[model samples]
Target: MILHTNDVFKVTRPEDIFETRGRFAYFRVELLSQKGNIDVSLKLTGRLDWTFTRSITLTRKTNDKGVAVFPVGRICESLIQGTKSNLITYVITASEYDHAGPALYAVPGFADREILPEWGDGENISQFYPAAPCIVVYPNAGFEQSLFFPKQTGELFVLTPSSTTTEKYIGNSAFSPIIPFDPAKIPSEDLGKPLAVGATPTDYNAEIRTYYDYCTKGIFLKWTDAAGIPYLYRWTQESKTDEMSVESTYHQLDDTLTPRDVQNKTLAKRYTLHSRIVERDVFNLCRTILGCQDLFMYDPDVGNWVRFMVEDSESEDTGAPMQDLVVEIVRYEYL
Candidate 1:
């Protein structure tokens, strides 16, 4: 098949940061083929591409009558470039096919935007509600939440742009190293058997772990959807301030542990496990509803973390109908 455009073009700035900067870029692709079945792939051919070197592929199959309007989607990673160039070069190639037909050359629209009005007009501000102590996450598509956690209070914005076509997680989503948290406590429901091994335990309080205070306090987590969409749920520690206690359980390091000592270890372990479960459950809930996969938690080692372990529907114990959807947590932070 004869290709329409020699190559595809994309435009972005500081190509390295797509997750926090929340910038938008325009992508243009030209398609040319004899029969329309152009088996083509697009790659970001730029120095900056290494920053977030990701790719998007579009496959068009001609209609029965040989007439097809191929739909192409642009992705942030696809437009990302390692080198600072005015225009990003994309190589589009196809295996030799039949002779070109009518020399059809179709150019897609550009998507780059000068400034995100949503960010400036305060459209996204409301979405960044405060989830004090810890934010509660639920399953809901098209609903997103965001918050800013500053190590030091200042005016600095981190952003990343996402394609409308990118696959987003719904509800009950899970990221890798899936940390399982106890589902929201039902008023009249009994929590089925204890959580599985290595899972976050329920009824955890502070005191036992010094780090819990840091993780739980000054936390600004925004539940959003695929492509960094925002929602309206907020969390506040004030409502339950009295409940924020650093209750501790002692650990009796003994060869022959006493019943009281065993209880203490169980309590300590439960506290730690509970924290993990909360993080995992909240993360998954956000991802499943948001519709973005690749869930990960930020760590010094990986530096850049992706959210994972998403489930879109309600669990068997929910006592509610399941919403078969994908959930994801796009952004989270602790100040």
Candidate 2:
């Protein structure tokens, strides 16, 4: 359909990030200066396909800036309205006096600025909101061709991009080990239950594990959908401060044959990472995985996925542009 690019009613919120059309957030639209005080209306769908299959309509007049913002709505109680996909689409529509006109996309529009969670924080995972995975494309320059992780249905697995290129984890989504390993060894919600003893993989994948050294790796947060779209999060550039602690648990034996000392059980390394300084978007992106009860991290030191925690209970945010983050993590998955 032909969209009216020069319409008086416009949406100026979801300024494109990278090459993506808009950020996944609320909808906001502004009226032309000459059209000030005019009524604006919006209809959003609970699906991601951008179709107005569901009917959710609202009307409001423009403010001084010719902009109208939608309230977060009663996410706690609102009945979600339709049974579309997990993702929701906000389609702002407007006309001079609330008369039927083209959709906000027909005009130009933006999304709400704040990355505030539409479904609230990780506080309630069982809530109706679903954190859909998004894909991003990387800039291709001089190098081997880029291959998306979580490859297509029948794509063969390739370990290396090229001889010169190091084994890289392009698709930052959960990965499957190159070679078969104990399912009990893998963590992270990406890989569900452990496989049967002799069962071959009929499902799943992993980040590269071959390339390893004594040195630490950069904290490059990443995510890519099966489509190969990439989303990179470089928080605080790199952490400025780091802290670690260890704890052990074991069973006591009162039997006369047993020794007085309770043998050490396991050493779970708990880490606290303090960022140098970062933007609010980085803060929000970092929180995407906080709701995962089975969240796991790949420990280069041990070359395995270990149970990971963000310590979200104590995390904080103030909405300012520049800020610092205190990330607490725990990594303990070893023999």
| TM agreement with the true structure for every prediction | 0.25, 0.31
Lowest summed lDDT across 10 adjacent residues in model 2 is found at: 134-143
CA-lDDT, candidates in order: 0.26, 0.36
**Among all candidates shown, the one with the greatest TM-score:** 2
Q: On residues 1-335, what C-alpha lDDT tens digit does candidate 1 reach at each position?
A: 11243322111222211232233232223333343553444343322333543344444454333333322223433343232221233443344322221211111122132221111222232222221222343222122323222111112221111111221111111111111222232111222211111111221111000011112222123334443333223223221111122335555656566434323111111000011223433433433333332333333355443442333333322432332222222222221
Output the lDDT of residue 262, model 1. 27
Judging by lDDT against the true structure, name the best candidate: 2
Residue 120's lDDT in candidate 2: 23
Q: Give the per-residue lDDT digits (tens) of candidate 2, residues 63-137.
A: 777878665233201323333222233556666333233222110112222122121222332221122222111
Name the lDDT of candidate 2: 0.36
Task: Please list the residue runs of candidate 2 whose C-alpha ends up more than 4 Å from where it truly belongs after superposition.
Answer: 1-5, 15-27, 48-55, 71-88, 96-294, 297-308, 311-335
